[model samples]
Target: MTDLHFLPGCRIEEITRPDANSLHICAEARRRSGRCPDCGEPSDAVHSRTVRHPADLPCLGREVRLELWLRRLYCRNPACSRRTFVERLPGLIAPRAQRTDRLATAHGRVGVFLGGEAGARMLTQIGMPTSGDTVLRLVRRLPLPRRPAPQVLGVDDWARRKGRTYGTILVDLERHRVVDVLPDRSAATLADWLRGHRGIRTIARDRSTEYARGIGLGAPQAVQVADRWHLLLNLRQMVERWLAGVHGRLRRLPPTVGQPAGPARRTGAFPRSQGERVASADSRERKKALYEEVRRRHAASEPLLTISQRMRLARGTVRKYAQAESFPERAVQAPAHSILDPYLAHLEARLAAGCENARALWRELRDIGFPGTSMQVRRWLGQRRSAPAKTTPRRYREAQPAPVPPDAHAGAPALPSPRQLALYLTRPRDGLTNEERSAIGRLERDPDAAAVAVLVRRFADLVRGSCIGGNAVVRAPIATFKRWLIDAQNSSVSAVATFAAGLQQDAAAVKAALTTPWSSGQTEGQVNKLKLLKRQTFGRAKFDLLRRRVLLAA
Candidate 1:
């Protein structure tokens, strides 16, 4: 049966199952002639024969063993240097190999997706048993894909070990697949890689100086587009820094003359009882004391790390304490309605009418949709009874109390964190909720915040492809960006001014980012995927094996 397609050019003389888990096939090369090793001459005289048992792909849950007969042919040419040469069956198996090419290919595929240990376990479970080392060897031996250099390339860095070692990843934007992974993130390495791929017409990357210098050194003619995501991220961080300096603007400010309070101050919950109010007040005091202690230790020039260890607090909390110039006060919020609110008047009326039985009042209210238990009614009455009696004289109480100005901070909302305010400033206005919109309105009370928001929105819109090129030189938005940059450069907020200066330094890349449509988004996505593949090996795989897996697995 020479029809066993896997062993092409070979004939099967006999096939039999030796055990339940395996099958054996007696096979030999069908070729009768072969070329001499040293001289280019064909030979048909068989000089010797040898037997080999090579393993192949599993067949129907059984291991396949082939009894192959390889023949040695005698060189008939008198001028040949070699006496004899073995016939090469390249289509079937490799020289001196213990397994067939088909089996190796299958194992390589398994190794590609699941690294060594996992692949070995999977192969054994699937009845094609093989060791992890063999699987890894097969994967490493695989040939990488061959393709021409891409015109549009994306480049970004990935952390080999975050905040420590890093590497660069290149992607073909058109194919959305990784092209290569460099061991380190450096200008020389990227320059070398880019020089080799001269076909690149556009290179999309982040606003990193190393990458920029590398591109200039290697592919000066290629256009460099800064990543839009990085641009907006930088903007948000600037906004956060500005907010940090002006923390008062992010909170609900005391009402000014004729200015009304915004809806952001609306409360979300209420104290369930008198005891709850007391408990909340006590908790606030405890928090105040702890904050004071943290700030006190920090002001003494103690390292925040030591403070965190002594206090059993997070390092971030310690840093926040050290950074605050004053104790951040929480704003007051109105109490929410409770289930007992509707029944309160009825219970009071009964108590005043000499019907002081709390259980009877609770039962009466239960018929009118009051879902609370009698214990709640009892607690309310007991609290009222336990309150200290007022000692004011009845005659003096009738006199009008001195006129008091309204509490300006009443019903104020708790201040949003700097990061939260930054999100509101950078995110689209259309996506904002009613509370966020109100917060924005409240924040605008500070003229500086209003001016900063205008600049932030303009920058965000430009980066998001909604450029406002009104009265620009060529309606190309480049002029509009320049004008906005000037406005930010002169801004009172140092954070925004600093960021604007950075943009001016990288003017070319920033401008190219606005004009070009390609970005480093694909490159960033590939880096994230690389993290997954790296973690698959528990971070133990060397760079060579990881690179091979990344290339071959693709």
Candidate 2:
């Protein structure tokens, strides 16, 4: 067959169609006479004729098969011990490798897209033949740059095999990239990583004692900042606990006593409000309906507890509700003006009169027939003391004189009214309810709201805090929240208090989100794209090559 020259010193010769699926090539190597093929010594000795063997090579389509014949030679050196040696091939792939280096590389790249076995199928479809393992091997052989440990570190744990094993991921804060993954989430393992890496000025980590211990042992100098996300989560749990407790305590109170207004009484426990009643009523209704259905069987001589067991409702509740024809109506009313209000004016007067004694106020309020308990008065006094200083009214006149009334003059523009300014400050968002709007107006006038506002103001303070120094702004609020949580007792204020606590602790991380914005949006998008690539590859492609393509594409 005639040879086709592809380039200088390289030719494609004798392209035999092995099958519709594979291409076979028989080509001669570039020949140059210098040393004996049998030995490296400069001896010229020609031995047997060429032989043919199967090999793989890069081709346009299908699978390209290479059939090569090379010469054998004898040593011409008189003193040489060797009789013959086969000629060594150049520009060929590793020994025993089925595919050419180029084809193997292509397979690896496609494998990452196809993933494992899927990639193998894809390569077959493309006419570049390969298997999943071949694609994996190709990926493993590729060189990757050795990265140094990061300066500022972030350590997070993920399930290796959920419920059995876990892995720790270490990220470089400065580079905003993953640096390494640890096999275990133990303190010893984490400490080892910290010890191996140097110059880590800070660590953002969860509230695990193991990590804290590790940081203490390995990178003592590095400031360990509680991750804002975890702090918020912890605060959420605290809120849930308090909310549940509040509901439970209210349950023991008389049904007729409605929710108390003003600072809620600690022991003059109020009845459930409409919102709480609705939830409780719904739960009761669900249970009652189940019990009635089950009780019919019970009435027909079924065991007493059997119906309860079948329905999964408490035996006592089932017995009580089963006798009734239907679910009972919810009895809830608007919370009343708290019994603490009568003492509010007196408490404020005492504060105005320079009395900071909470215990003293409790006694004074108790003597005035305050239906509520001492704990309630004490809490109210505490809130009053912490409230901000009231703002004095400021008078201002417009620079321009008021225009004449529109109907009075020949041509006059109307002047803006003071009510507009009042509305702007006091009004809630347009669609807000009357109660919500009133709350806003109260917040505008009262010092208590201002105190709450101070904590709310911490949100913005944290944003500016980042620019001030080396992440000190975040630490301050986190510390404050910790203090509040430790001392918190009143369940009424606990929800908002915990929310404040969460904000304080997580302020830094959330601000980091606002400023740097490390959202999972892009990562999630890539994961979705990866799913497609895997489907295309048919689950046969290698992971290393898939990873390479994903990273390179990024």
Candidate 3:
């Protein structure tokens, strides 16, 4: 209806909605006296009057423009700088700003959250039109907050470029806010920062030796706690290494192509399906023809490149074919198991029964406990719908599908990868999938695997306390960790022993982690946020801008 109010010492003259998307307000400052910024002297003498047009916050989805009339007051005192000055609006628009303080704050906040380009686009759509560069300028102009030294600090490193460069971020653990970001994760840089803020009582960090050394140099009195997650991660890595050492024994080879699938023997070749066999035969026939041609051309003194170009094959392949005494059969690798294995037969049966609509078939399969999405079903349906007339004909309409080999991988499941098995060991028993549960069951049957599992579970309990024998759980974790360390060191598994030795090197931090509630987990989450901001700028931001964004903003 009207321009209700403005600055404390200003009066509104007129309010007009110029268009459907714009609001213009005319206001004037009615100050009794103004102060000269140069000499801090009160002046009532009017040198000249001036009109200021500044942008305000949008009103009712329309852009707001403010035209404020103010006086250019002259300094009265001779002691003050004898010059005219534009009167200031202390709580509204700044002396030289083109927008209200509140509006600039809104732009700056958006810029900090979304960064330049995205913030500018967002501001334009929201009726505060501004350029990306302007938003960035506003963000950089924002003053950094004065934060006191944290009582408990969480320190961690984030890669500026992974495996090449790294930076450090310190967070106030109690307040859960980023305190500052450093250029590098070096001990000296962190030590300098820590020395400056001497009030830190505890420091939570990862098991990096650099950080340990830094903490030692910076604040020796501060209690250093190793992150429990890192401790667990190190154990998993050790488990993987042990698995790697014995991988040959753990891995079962596939049966040779021509041999009937039986107990896994040291077969040199892989199994092939009937279709793969057909495909391989056709491929070999074509290669044999090509090989003959290559040999004939080679005998005629043709260049390898010429032969390759003529045959549309690689020179190496042509040379290889030409060099062979006979056309060698291409080795076939075992076909990987697909997600459609369980539903393949049922899908074939349904297709034979004349259900052709992929969408309907997908819904039917979904009702019968199918886990795959409809897109896979649709694609498979497209292939199967045409495969009937091609691969399968009326002559083989009544023929049954081939039976799976009794003693093959179908009967005895394949072993999981070493990294996968290590994760399975680290994961909670109750949270495992049914297949993972069965896999672990089979793994425990092995004496080596059984011993490793026992040690891993014990170490896990020491770090993350477990309920044992109905409420008689571990209370003194540091003591438990010490005993576990001795047991792990004496274990038959060399990898486990190696892991235990590493814990002994940083026994204080390890013990502190087991006993204390603090961790660098929160700091890790902040690093992820930092990464998001860095990537949003397409990795072009330097350390200074990145530091400002990470520290000054949330």
Candidate 4:
């Protein structure tokens, strides 16, 4: 048979099968090394020979092990401090390594792609048995490849231990890869990192004062661009606060003198889970006690902070409780997802076909693949059946048309939450549904809300590169944004005024965000990736490993 040349520059001599899944091959190095590693002088004197066993890539579905016969050479140069050195096996394995170069490379790639435990399992499944720790070590030892400096950088902060410690994530926006991760979110750390890497012409970041200060100090020449998504998000939060303050004004208009009062409003009396009911009752009792104590303290003319200290509650909580109002209700928890979610379409089809019996629906669901109980189906059906039914209005006898009652349409849509309202306001008018349009029209009737809506729409037009008038698309200029900011400030809306002030402080960045297209969206995507890596390791991995995985994987 021909010589086995699986490994170049090495001759395979004896092959032994220790087990059905193992192959041990004894081999000797072919080349005679004569170079002294330290002195760089040629030495051919052989000192001794030794056997080094190192794992190699699997061959033909069997684990391959190489028993390499290596030789030690004496350094012939007397002037060199080194006495003896091991013969180097070029392209095969590194000194003191337990695996061949190619095998280590393969394992490193595996670790980078799948991470520790998952990668270990994958290697074992592929006939290469190795520990997770070994895989991670191999990955850690791999050298990082050099990259050219990016001109456009994106900066953001991610929580290391949320609400306690945070780190900065810098990304090359043009290449869409993370550049580096700083240990802390401090301005000094970020500024130091920025000062090290020059040639950054533009930086896209959020409205973080610390990051802004860092950029100003480190790279004053670089143009800063505020992220549009963050700007819109900030605007939404302001709008929500404004809406919360004026929520009472959003109530339905009172009925006219001759108009008949509508039917008593249907309240949700459906049975809730017992555990949830108990929890909610307990929470309500706690809030009531806290509110009573807060009111008692306020009646005695105690300061907010003093009350908070006495009650061991936050000052904000004390303030909220002290305000003259009834106990605030706890937000209702949304119902959890049921097994019926997969069969919702089928159930809807059956319901449209006049199948209203809960038992029948449950039987049909079980006939397919639903593993849920009949009670869930009953609860769902009860909700559907109990919904307020729409009724036609009776014709009025008066000569002039009677004013329509606020609840004239019995199927009037439920009022949406502030978040939903913000969504409707920010989205294009043409894309809105009939109900959403009606909601917007109702909201516009309030002067404050109307002013905020106008500003929001103008901001949306600027961001989306479209003009607001008659679908005549044109990119909104910085001048229009400035004018809008001035309008918001003068509108007497506290939330809008605060937002406008923030924009004015970062006026240049905000202008660049509107006029220029640079954004920190790519950097945010990288932060998401970092979060995934952190989760994969169960958050036990150190920052070094996480940093390596993020950079190498990218």
**Winner by lDDT:** 3
In the predicted model 4, the residue pairs found to clash are none
**Per-residue alpha-carbon lDDT of candidate 4 for residues 1-554, written as tens digits (9 for 90 to 100):** 11433777777878888999978999887775657889988777889988999998887788888899877889988899999987887798888999999899899989987888999999998878899999999999888867899899999999888878888899998888888888788889988888998999999999999999999999899999899888878877777656644644553422123223333323223455557767867987988888898999999999999999978998757865765345544322223445666777787788788777888899999999889899878866755643322331344222232222233324444345556778888888999866567667777777878888998888776766621333232344777887888898887777788888888999988877776667888898999998888788887888898888888877
Candidate 2 segments exceeding 4 Å error: 1-10, 18-22, 31-58, 71-91, 137-144, 173-177, 248-554
lDDT of each: 0.78, 0.52, 0.79, 0.77
lDDT of 1 by residue, 282-350 (tens): 987987787799989977988989999999988866765566555554543434556777677787778
Superposed model 1: Cα runs more than 4 Å off: 1-5, 36-41, 75-85, 255-409, 466-474
**Positional deviation of 42 in candidate 4, in angstroms?**
1.8
* Tens digits of lDDT, candidate 3, 232-276: 898888787676546445443432222233322221123345798
Which pairs of residues clash in candidate 3, taking residues 3 or more apart in a chain or in different chains? none
lDDT of 3: 0.79
Query: Order the candidates by lDDT, highest first — what do you get?
Result: 3, 1, 4, 2
Best by TM-score: 4
What is the C-alpha local distance difference test score of candidate 4?
A: 0.77
Cα RMSD of predicted structure 4: 8.9
Candidate 3 Cα errors over 4 Å, as ranges: 1-5, 79-81, 252-410, 466-475
List pairs with backbone clashes in candidate 1: none
Residue 62, model 4: Cα distance from true site in angstroms: 2.2
The residue-by-residue lDDT of candidate 2 on 1-554, one tens digit each, is 23331312224567778688777777665544325444467533667646445445345556666766555666777777777655545455444455555556676666555566776777778676666777767766655545666666777665444567665666666665556556678999999888888888767776666877888899988766655445444443533333232322222222211223334223212333456757865897776567567667767887758877877777755654544333422322233467675556677678889876666777777777766776676555544454322331333121222232222212211111222212322222565444334333433343433343333334333433333333333455445434544444222353456555544554444444333323333223344554465455554434444445444333
Q: How far off is residue 147 in model 3, in Å?
A: 3.4
TM-score of every candidate relative to the true structure: 0.75, 0.48, 0.74, 0.77
The per-residue C-alpha lDDT of model 1 at residue 110 equals 88
